[model samples]
Target: MIAVPRAQLRRPLLSSVLHILSVLFVFDLVFAVTSRSLFSACASLALVGLVAAVSNAKYESLREPFVFTDLSLFSQLFSHPRLYLPFLSVGKVVAIGAGIVLVIAGFIVERPVLPGSRALVWLAAVLPFALAFPVAARLPLTLDPYVDQCRNGFFAVFVAYLLNGLRPATFRRFREVVAAGPFATGKPIRCPDVILIQSESFFDARRLGDEVAPELFRRFDDARREAVWHGEITVPAWGANTMRTEFAVLTGTESFSLGYARFYPYAFVRNKIASLASWFGRCGYDTVAIHPYYADFFGRDRVFPLLGFARFLDIRHFASASRAGPYVADASVAEAIVAELEAADDDRPRFVFAMTMENHGPLHLEQVLPGESSSRHTLGEHASWRDLTAYLRHIENADAMIGRLLDHLRTSDRETVVCFYGDHVPALPHVFEKLGVNPQHSDYFIWRNYGADAPERRNLAAEELGAALLRVVQDHGNRAEQPHASEKAT
Candidate 1:
C-alpha cells in the first residue's frame, strides 16, 4: 500500500476548486455579454463552451446557435485567417485567448477543471456525459421547462432525443425529408442567367417625402422604372439579421417555419434540403454566390455548397483597389459580376447571388455644420443628420451600381433576369425614431433586360419573392441546356 501526505492531497483539492471557479468565471463573464442574465449563462455553460469552440475555429465574432452548428466552417475559417481576422473585435480576441489559457492551465496547473483526479484530464472531459442518466429525466420538479433540476444534465436529455431520432421507427420520416422534390416545376425551362442583388440598406428614402428632398432619390427613382416586378417586401427581421432574409430567398421557406432559426438560419439547420440553387443546379445553370466580405461570415463559405452553389466569390476575390469606404464598393461588385458573365460568355446560363456590403452599420460620419449642408443635394440641414447623409451617399452609389448592372445585362445578347432587393433596414436607431420610418418593410424591384410588363407595386414576404422570380424566369427562356464551363464538374 502507498501512503500519501495530507498536505499534498489537500493542496490538489484546493487547486481543483480554484481551477473550476476560474473556468466558470471566464465563461460567465464571456457569455454574459449576450445572455440576458448571468445565471442563464452559467446554466448554459457547456453550451457556451460548445459555441466558443466553434467560434474560435471560424474566426467568428459571436457564438449564437448560427455560429455553432458546423465545425467544418470553423476549420475553413482557420485555414484562411487573413479573410476574417481583421473583422473580429479586440474584446472577442482577448476572451478567446483567455479561454485557451484556462484550458491549458487545467491540464498543468494546481488542479484539473474536471471533478476527479487532476491527472485525468481526458476522463474529466467525458465525466459530465458519462454521469448523465435516464433516471434524472424522471425528476419530480424542474426549474427550466425543458430540463429538470440539473442544467448540464440537459445534455443527457439531448442525447436521448438524438438517439430517439435515429430509431428504426423514425427512419421513414428522415428519408422523406432527405428525398424532397424540385423547385421550378414548369416544363424544365432553359432558364436565362439569374442575378440576385441583396443590396445593403438600399431603399428609396423618397417614401418619406416630408423628411427628405425629392432630388436625393433621382437615381433610385430612375432604376425603379425599369423593373418588371416592383414592390415592398416584409422581411423576417426588422433592423438587422441579414441571414433571415438570405435564407428565406435561397430556400423560399416561409418565416413561420423557421422558428428560432430565423435569427441565424446558416447555423441552426444542417439538412440537405432543396433550394433555389439546388433547383438551378438540376437545370445545369452555373450557380455562384458572391459577397464582398469574409468567406466565413455567417458560415456562407460552407453553406453555399449545401445550397448548391458551384462557386463563391468573396472579399479575397476582389482587388484591394476596389474598396471605397468600409468595404468593397458596390461599383466594384457590379463590375465583378459583369466580368464573370463576360468570361463565361460561352452562352451557358448563370445564376449569380451577389450580396453587397458597402452600407454596413455604425454610420457615424463627419457632421455637416448647421448651415454647411451641401447645396448640391437637398437633404435638410445635414449636420444633425450626419449618419442619414452618409447612408444616402452610399445609396446613391448603390443606385449607380444598379444602373451599371442593368445596362450590362440589357446590352448582352443572351436573355437575362435580375432581382434587386434590400436584405433589411439599416439599424439607425436615432434615424428610425426621428423619421418614424417603418423599418420592417424594405423595397425590392425585379428587372430584366427585356421582358413583359409586371404587375403594379404590391407588398410580399421575403420568402415569396423567389417563387415569383422563378415564374418570371420561366417566361424569359430559363434553363438553356448549355453547360457553363465553370460548373463542368456537376
Candidate 2:
C-alpha cells in the first residue's frame, strides 16, 4: 500500500503535482548518494509514513495536527523518547524501528548507482536542490497548519510552512507584538514576596467520577476558599506544551497574537518583551525561576534571563531533592521555593516562579500504587483506571505542595502572595475518552497572606492570569496605605 493515504491525497492538481515532485526530489537525492533505486524508494516512502504517523499521533493526543513548529522539537524528541514514545502504540514503534534498520542496511549493502564518478554523483545530488528552488518559490502557502496539511500533502505542507517561517515578515510581526509595554506598571507601597507555582497536569480528578475522592484536592479546595481570586483559566495548550500557557501567563500576551510563535514562544521570539518577572524586577523585587527539569528542554536557560529573571534554579538545584516517581517530587520543589525566599539576607521582595514536574505524564509507564486502583481513586476496574490512579497519586503530592506553600506564605511576617495554577491538563486521552470528558480548562487561583479583599471568583484566559494577579497585588498595596478606622478617628 502507498504510504500516502487516499484521504490525504484528495487535493487540487497543483498540490498533487507539488507533493509528487517533493517525494521524487527526496528519492533522487538519496538514490544519487547511495546508488540504490530500491532503497531510495523505500526511504522516501518511509519518510511519508513517519510524517503521517506523527501528525496522527499528535492530533489524537493533543487535538492538533503536526505543523512546522513541531519540527523544532525533532532533535529533542530523539533525546527525550520517554516523553513522546509512549503516545505511539507498540506496533507503530516497531514499524518505525524496522524502517530505520532498513534504511541503515540499504546504505551499507547497496552498491553506488554512479560508482567511480564522484563528480557526477555530486552533480546528481545538487540537481534536486536546484530544481526544488523554483518549485518552492511559486508554491501556494497557508498559515493555518491543519487546513494546509489536509488540503496539500504532508511533505508539501511541511515544506510550505518551513519556507513561510523563514520569511522576514514573520519575524517583523513577532517583534511588533512583543514591543508592547510591560505586563504591569507602578510600584507597590510595599513589595511582597510572590510565589507562583505552575503545577504539572493538575486538575480536579473528582471530575472523572464519584470514585475520585474529593479529599484528593482538599488542600487545593482550602486554598480556593481563602483565595483573593479563583477560577477555571483557559490555557493555550491541552495535554502538553506547558510553555505556551507559561508564556501567556508570564508575558500577558495571548497565544493567538503570537502567530506561528505561539507553538514554541521560548525558542522563536528572540527579543524579550514585558513579562510578569520583568515587571516585578522593576518594582525592586528579586526575580527567580525554578523548574525541576532540564533547563534547556525549551531553551529556558537562555530565555529566562531575557525574561528578567535574575537567577534560574533548574534540575541542578534540585539534585538533592527526593523523587516521587520518575521526576523530582513537587514537595521538594515547594521546599526549594521556601528556601529561596528565606535565604535572602536583604529585605528585597522576591518573585519566584516554579514549574513542577512530578506529575508530568506518560503516567501509564509507572505502576499504580498497590491501592491506587481502589474505589477511592477509580470508580471501577476500567481500562483507564491505572492511568487515572497514577495521576491521582502524583496529584496528591501536588496538593500537598500547595498546602505546604500556603502554610509558609500564611505565616510569613512580611506580606506575601501565592499563585497556583496548572500548566495544562494531563495526557490522559484514554481516561477522558472513557469518561466522556472534554478536557479543556485548567484551574487557577491567586491568594494573599494578609488582605481584607473579599474572595472573587472569575474565569480568565491564561494570558490574563498575570494581569489579574498583578491587580490583586496592587489592590493589596493600595489598601495597605489607607488610614484605618481607629487611625482616622484619632
Candidate 3:
C-alpha cells in the first residue's frame, strides 16, 4: 500500500478544527446578548459543544452506518405532520437568511483569510452549530440527507432566536405534537363489581432480609389470605409519575398508542377510557374514583371522568378527615371507598378505583417517618441498604392499609372483588444499582401476583394491563355463570 500523505491528514484535521471553531463563534454571539460577556459565552459553548460532538461521534461510530431511510420516524412525524408546518414556515426562511448572512459576515470581518485572520469566520460558524447541535443530534439518523438538512435549517432559525435571547415559538408546537391523539373510546362491557387499588411502591424487598419493615411483611402475609399476592413488581419510576402506570392499567393501550416511547399517562392519554369504571357503568354499576391526592395532580379530574367515573373524591373532599405527608392517608381513601359504597343511590352494583398516597416518595426511612426510631430500627446505616428497608416499610404501610380494606370488605354483606397491584417500584436509584434491575422490568410483577389457581401471567406492557384485567373479569363472569347453569340442570 502507498503511504498516506501528511497534507491529506492535516486537511481533515484542519477542516474539523475550523468547523468546531465556526460552531463556537455563532454560539458565542447568540449567548453573549444575554450572558453579557463574549469570552465567558464562547468558553461555555466550546466546553459543551466539544462534549456533545464527542458523544455524537462515538454514538455514530457504534451504529450500523446511519441509514437515512426508515418509515417509523417518518410515520411518527407524519402522524401529526400538521404540528411542524408552523416551525417549517418560520424556520426555513429565517435560518437560510441568517446562515447566508453569517457566512458572508465571516469573510468580510476576518482579514487575510488565513488561519489567524479567519478566526472570526470560524467562530461564527462554530457557535451556531454549537447552539443547534442538540436539536440536530436528536434527529433520526435514518432520515434522508435533505431531511437532515431541513432539520439544520430549523436549528439555524432556533439559533437566531437564541442569539437574540428570545424563546422560540417551537415550544408550543412541540406540546401540540405530544398532545395529538384521540381519547380512549369503545363500547363498554358490563362486568362484576370492580375494586382496583394502586399500592404505592409495592415491590418485594424480602430479598434484603431483615432490612425490610416487619409490619409490611406481616401485612403482605395477611393480604395473601383474601387477595392474590404478587411477590415483586417491577415499576417504571422510583418515586414519581405513578399515575402513568394507573392510566395504563385503566386503558388497554400501550405508550406507543399515545405516540410515546416511554410511559407518560398525563401527556398522551386525553380521551374517555373503557376502563373498569366505564365497563361496570355499562353493566348497570355505580362508578366512583377515589384518590387522597389533589384532584388535578395528574389531570385526573379530566381523565377519571373519561375512565367512566361518575364522581371522584380527592384531597379537597377529605380536607378535614385525616392527614399523611402532603396527601390524605391510604386509610382515609379506604374510608372514602366505603362511604361511596354506602351512598350509592342506584340499585346497580358499585365499582371504585382508589389510589393510595400515604406511601408516596423520597422513600428514605428518615423522610417518611420523622423522629420515629421504630421506623428506623429495621434499616441500617448503609445508604444502599437503608433505601430498600425504607421501601419495604412504605410497602408495609400500604399492605396494612390494604388489609384493613379487605377486612372491611369481608365483613360487609355486598359481594366485592378487590384487585390490587403496585403501580411501579420505589424510586431508589441505589437499590436498582445493587439489584441490577432494568427499568424495563417495571411491568414484570404481574407474573408474581398471579396465583396458582389464577390464569397464567404473561409479561405485559403497562397499557396492556387493562386488557388483562378485563380478561380476568370476564373469566370471573364465566365461572359465575357455570355454577348457575349447573344448579339449573340439577
Candidate 4:
C-alpha cells in the first residue's frame, strides 16, 4: 500500500483553522473601534466566527476547490493598505488620526470598552463573508469573485453607516414610501347602517389543529350565516399598527396604496378622508366610532373627525371597566356600544364602529385571563402551541362578548347589523419557524371557517371589505321581506 502524505492529512484541518481565523480577524478589526481590548475582542469574534463557520460547514461541504481573482483578493486585503506606509500616506494619516481621537476619548471617559460590546460591530463588518460562505458552499463556486465584491461593498458600507449614524433623510424617505394615502377609489356605495368591529389579533389560528377554542369556532360558524363573513383578509402590519388597519377598513383603501396615508393619523392630518362614516352621514345615517382604549393612543380624536363621525366614544365614555390583558375588556366595549346605540336619535338609523383591545401583546396565559386558575402548562407557555392556545382563550372571551351583543340586538326594536373581523395575526415572532407555516402563505388562511352558505371562497383586503359588508346588509333586508314574498306567491 502507498503511504499517505502527512501534509494531506493536515491540509483540511489547516484550511478550516485559517478560515475561522480570517473571519475572527475581520470581526476584530471592525469591533476594535468600540472594544479597545484586542484579546477579548479577538476571542469573542473567534467564538462567533467558529459557530457560524462550523454550522455552515456542517450543512454544506467545504472540500470543493474554488478559483478567485488575485486583483479582488488584493483589494480586499488592502482595503486601506496605506496604513502600513512610512509617511505622507493619506490612508495611514487618517487611521493615525482616528486612533489618536479614540485614545483621547478613552482617557477622558475612564471606562474600557468590553469584549462583547463591539462584537456586533465587528460581526457587521464581516457579515458578507459569513453569509456568503454557506451559500457558496451549498451552490456552485462560479462567480465567487463578483459575489464577494458586491457583498463586501454593499454590506461594509452599511455597517460603517450603522456604526456611525444613519441620516434622518433615510427615515423620511421610508416614511414617504410607506406613508401613502387614500388607497381606495374613495367613492361611497350607498348602504344601510354600518357596524364595524376591529377585533384584536383576530387571526384564525385553528388551522393548526381542531382542538383550539372549539366553542369559538362554533360561534364563527353561526356568525357566518348571520353576516357576510369574508375569510383570508390580509392585515398590513403584524403586531401593532392597529390604526392603519382601522384607517384602511373605514376609508375603503389600502393604507400603502396612496403615496401618503400609510403613516396612520399623520396621513389623516395631511389629507381629507371620506370614510364609511362620512359616506353614511351623506345618506342620513347617524355615525359613531368607539374604542375601549385611551382616545389619544393613535390620535383617534383628530382622525375620527376626518372620517366624518359625529361622535367618538372611548374608554372615558364607558360606565363600567372590564380588563382583558392591558386594555379595556371586549365585554365592556360591547356593553358601551349598546349604550351608544340606545342614546342615538331613534329617527335616523345608526352606524357604529367599535374596536376591542383586550387581546393585545405578550400573550402570557396569565396576562390574558388574569385570575383564571387553569394550569399554565395547559396554555403551552414556552412553545408556539401554548402561545396559540392562550391567544384562542382571549378570542373565546371576545366571542362571548359578541354573543352578548347579538342577544342585545335581537331584543332591540331597531334592525341592527354587525360586521367584525380580526385586525391581524398574533405576536408570535417564532410562529413561522415553530409552526412551519410559510409567511407568504398568509392569503391561505380564511377568516370565515368552512361552513354552510358562506361565499364560495375568497381572499379579503381592506378595499374589498366595505362592499362585502354592504352585501350583508342587503341580504339581511331581503331576508326580512322573504316571508311577505312567499305569502304573495300563495
Which candidate tops TM-score?
Answer: 2
lDDT (Cα, 0-100) at 264 in candidate 2? 82
Candidate 2 structure quality by residue, lDDT tens digits, 28-51 = 777776778888988998888888
Against the reference, the lDDT scores of all candidates come to: 0.60, 0.79, 0.49, 0.52
lDDT of 3 by residue, 264-355 (tens): 44543445545657766776777788787667655678777877789888877888877655446777777787787667554577778888
Q: lDDT by residue for model 4 over 38-112, one digit each (tens)?
A: 544444544443333322321121111111111122332244332112212355346445655654554455545
Q: Output the worst ten-in-a-row residue range by lDDT, candidate 1.
A: 1-10
Worst 10 residues of 2 by lDDT: 1-10
lDDT digits (tens) for residues 162-239 of candidate 1 = 333334544444334333433644434546788888988666666654556566556556557756678898887554
What is the Cα root-mean-square deviation between model 4 and the actual structure?
A: 15.5
Q: Rank the candidates by lDDT, best first.
A: 2, 1, 4, 3
RMSD of 1: 11.7
Model 4, CA-based lDDT: 0.52
Q: So what's the TM-score on candidate 4?
A: 0.57
| Model 2 CA deviation exceeding 4 Å by range | 1-9, 115-147, 181-186, 481-490
Q: Which has the higher lDDT value, candidate number 2 or candidate number 4?
A: 2
